[model samples]
Target: MSNRDYSLSDVVALLVESGDNASTFYRYSDDVPMPSVEVLSEIVEDLRTVLFPGYYGPSEITPDTMPYYIGSTLDRVERHLADQINRGYCFVCDKNKVDRCQDCETRSRNMARAFITKLPEIRELLLSDVEAAYDGDPAAKTHGETIFCYPSIRTMTNHRIAHELYKLGVDIIPRIIGEMAHSDTGIDIHPGATIGRSFFMDHGTGTVIGETCVIGDNVRVYQGVTLGAKSFPKGDDERLIKGLPRHPLVEDDVIIYAGATILGRVTIGKGAVIGGNVWITRDVPAGAQIVQSRAMQQSFSDGGGI
Candidate 1:
């Protein structure tokens, strides 16, 4: 070992130059690939436009050709979704077994088929989300704007779709969907979080709903709200606990305002309203309104007192 032909710095430089950064924009490496958000977003746009017709994307949807248009759009979405899913599947597959792709192909088909089968239900959930946003926000004139512009709607839509995939046991795909929306909207909703019907996240930004958080129906949350873990549970080896219910359980009709961080297994009771910037670790009674202040104000009104 007199002298190395290539120094450590020289090897590092070569590695960086050969990495993903050196690739042409047209080509992407699966080893460190960009989530096909641009492609998937277009798919979602087309799919949503088809699903809700005049209420979501294109306004030129005609009654006579509505069914035809929807069918065509669904077909295209299915193809596009399946293609990307297959790419993801193969990417994550054993690099050495790339030639044995039967399993990957089957997985992709099954995943795509399951997602396609759940389309009607997904649309129903998204329909409620649109209604919730419209009713919650005064500026939302119509569902069209909510679908197009509202960050909450986008985040929830991605969560709902991703949750479905997660339930189907398609790993990574769900995160990709959630992260895609997160990149665009600045809202972080884990697909594993359980959120019930008629939920509304008002002016949602910087909101983080951790995995294992259970949110009930008619729950409303505002911007900068976080339902996170009180403390990380570690194993005998001292590794942080996994798959535990670490976040808050917000019951039906609970309203949490901006900048509120409700941690632990605490239950914000049914019809409770949590005000802005408050950090809560304990359980709350039903129909209680906890506002921010030195006084710890309680309005005694369920949810928003509405």
Candidate 2:
């Protein structure tokens, strides 16, 4: 029945109507190009190679050949990162209805160069993370095994890179980078989260660290743990507010076990230990140990009476 009635002209008309309906979600700016996820994926890998040169890159890396490899890798990173960062800048400008695209090229190049310069710092922090993972897990044989085989290593590496871009005020790309790691590792860490040194995630799958979370040094968390906001505040227009500090602030040396969910902007003081499967919404003092209390049981009569 459809074959007898529909023609190519009718199909073209329907396609036009569909496109019209999709206009609200489409970006129409010709000057602004969306950041490429594929390109960003490659950028993350390249940066990883730089951070752990011999481990991630070619196996032939030696002390004598390190300089040439590093120099060439850095050059490639600069070129690709500048292009992607420029796209990110333009995309944000278009979304915010700002007319700063003219200067974005210069800004992107400068930001990329600045980011490259921070590689040493990033590498230092990542080493701390790797150390934390190795020390926290007794099963880990060596730092190299943890670096190559652990999901936390992959997730944190991506997070550290994305966090740097976020700090530099780059938009969209950070979130994209975060999502890439999330997809690959099953660990979700927001780019805006302020994580400190020696952060460790053991069995990191299903861990969620929300945006605005401030984690201090030597903090460790386990699988299925969530440091998240309890609720969202709505404005007069009923729109959810943005940019508020909503996630928890975890202090140094805190250990949150598996399935522990800490909500809102509560603080977990230094040296505190949160036990598995506990739900916390309030601040816990220093050196405190939080665990779920035992459930009370009631005796019942035989059959149906209580």
Candidate 3:
């Protein structure tokens, strides 16, 4: 071993040199104000309080004070969310060329207000999801329990909020919100996935729903299920094409069991039951049951079959 002395100053200098490299994906200067995860987390908490009322925020909230509490929380959420949205816009803006004169603050405020207006609808969808969870899971005692305790509810709540922001064309912030949920729960759902009402994920861990997936109403899925792409298409320039519908299309009343991997742009028809540990890449007809074939028992001298 060669003896070498390395000071903290030397390490700092090396890091500075690496950061100054133009080939690296580094954000500086105009990207001074990036979307903050801390602020975004606080915004999520405030929004959750607005959505679930007494379940998330203060426990002493009476019906009389509920309206006031919700209003105040919404006001805070709007202000903070608008700021984060503006940062997201600024992060992507070509300040030297296209968006130098863009009114990002105004646009962000308008987007935040638009998201606030849709809270009632988002709550309606969440109510449906809560009910679906209660009805689907025999262990669930009440819909309130699902709202208060279930990771699915929390994850879905974040997804619903993120989905709205994605629809409103706000970038970065939605993904941060989605990732917050994913960090808490093992479920990873892309913000771009379009999901209808009454969706329930039983046990919920390790479930991955990809971008461009369109899931219909009253759909239920178990843990370890993957709704992913089969393959990625590339352009003539050798860069992988994006924004294409590569994920599965799950229809109404479909039930996907645990450990099932449904890949590609395949359509899962209405009322279909996908069995556990099954791998599917093609479209299924309505009212079909897809399951793994029976395992054959064979005698082996070396006990390999066991």
Candidate 4:
């Protein structure tokens, strides 16, 4: 075979090798399915349409037709989400080699129903988020524009749905949902993070909110902001520990500028302003403004040597 081509035996060998490697890098099991990224993406779109009626929803939806569209959209969301959630449950069970996963479908249905019920609450939070985005940005033309055009809204919409699933204790699917938005919007918000009302990300890109982050209400963060962990504890076997609160606890009304990395379990107090490119590891008191230090300039007389 040439360098650009492969023989039949070689292709079969490559496929067999990849199948073997799946046990290490991926999940694989017979009779059990994994969560489909395409299905999850569809679910997100349906939920978005249901949440923001008349925006991405049916064109004929009006005061009388709203209920019909909402009901149908929610039914589709529940069906698709329940299937994916069941697959997520089965994926975990298969990984742990648990033989009893017969109840996964039931649990998934219940969780999906619960999540569907919370759509109104999620919509309310998103509305407030839209208002905050409009209020925070000077260039915003209207609240509707912010809702339809802002990347922050897109990120938060995905986050809110994923967070609801996370809170319901569903495995694998929440993270996948969060990543879908991250891939599209360049905002990396973990589903495990808890964000409050009126949260806004202005010019949001290169923003990394870690898994354990707890952000408060009315907080606005600019682009390239990282609310991340400083370090993670390791086990005696040299495995990194999980579930510790490592990311920052940002309180209400705090503003973190671009490229500011606030690490550890430190609390960013209410009303504090973190300047751009600042590396913060300690707790900040309320109303504090952290900025880069002043630089000193030295004038040289000699052109030949230092």
TM accuracy, model 4: 0.91
Q: After superposition, which runs of candidate 3 have C-alpha atoms over 4 Å from their true positions?
A: 1-4, 22-25, 94-98, 294-306
**What number of backbone clashes does candidate 2 have, counting pairs of residues 3 or more apart or in separate chains?**
0
- Candidates in order, TM-scores: namely 0.81, 0.91, 0.92, 0.91
Q: For model 3, which pairs clash? A: none
Q: How much is the lDDT of residue 64 in candidate 4?
A: 91
Whole-structure CA lDDT of model 1: 0.79
* Stronger candidate by TM-score (2 vs 3): 3
Candidate 2: regions farther than 4 A off: 1-24, 295-306
Candidate 4 structure quality by residue, lDDT tens digits, 1-306: 685699888988878887885776566676777789999998999888888877885667799988888888889889999999998988888878888566778989999999998888999999999999999999999988888899999999999999999999999999999999899899999999999999999989999999999999999999999999999899999999999989999999999999999889998889988889988787887887777754210111121100
Kindly report which residue stretches of model 1 are placed more than 4 angstroms away from their true locations once superposed: 1-35, 55-57, 95-102, 297-306
Deviation in Å, model 1, residue 67 alpha carbon: 1.5
Per residue, candidate 2 scores C-alpha lDDT tens digits across 224-269 of 9999999999999999999999999999999999999989989888
Writing each residue's lDDT as its tens digit, candidate 1 over 150-210 gives 8887788788888988788775678888888888788998989999887888888899999
Worst ten-residue run, lDDT, model 1? Answer: 297-306
For candidate 3, report its TM-score. 0.92
Task: Count the clashes in each prediction.
Answer: 1, 0, 0, 0
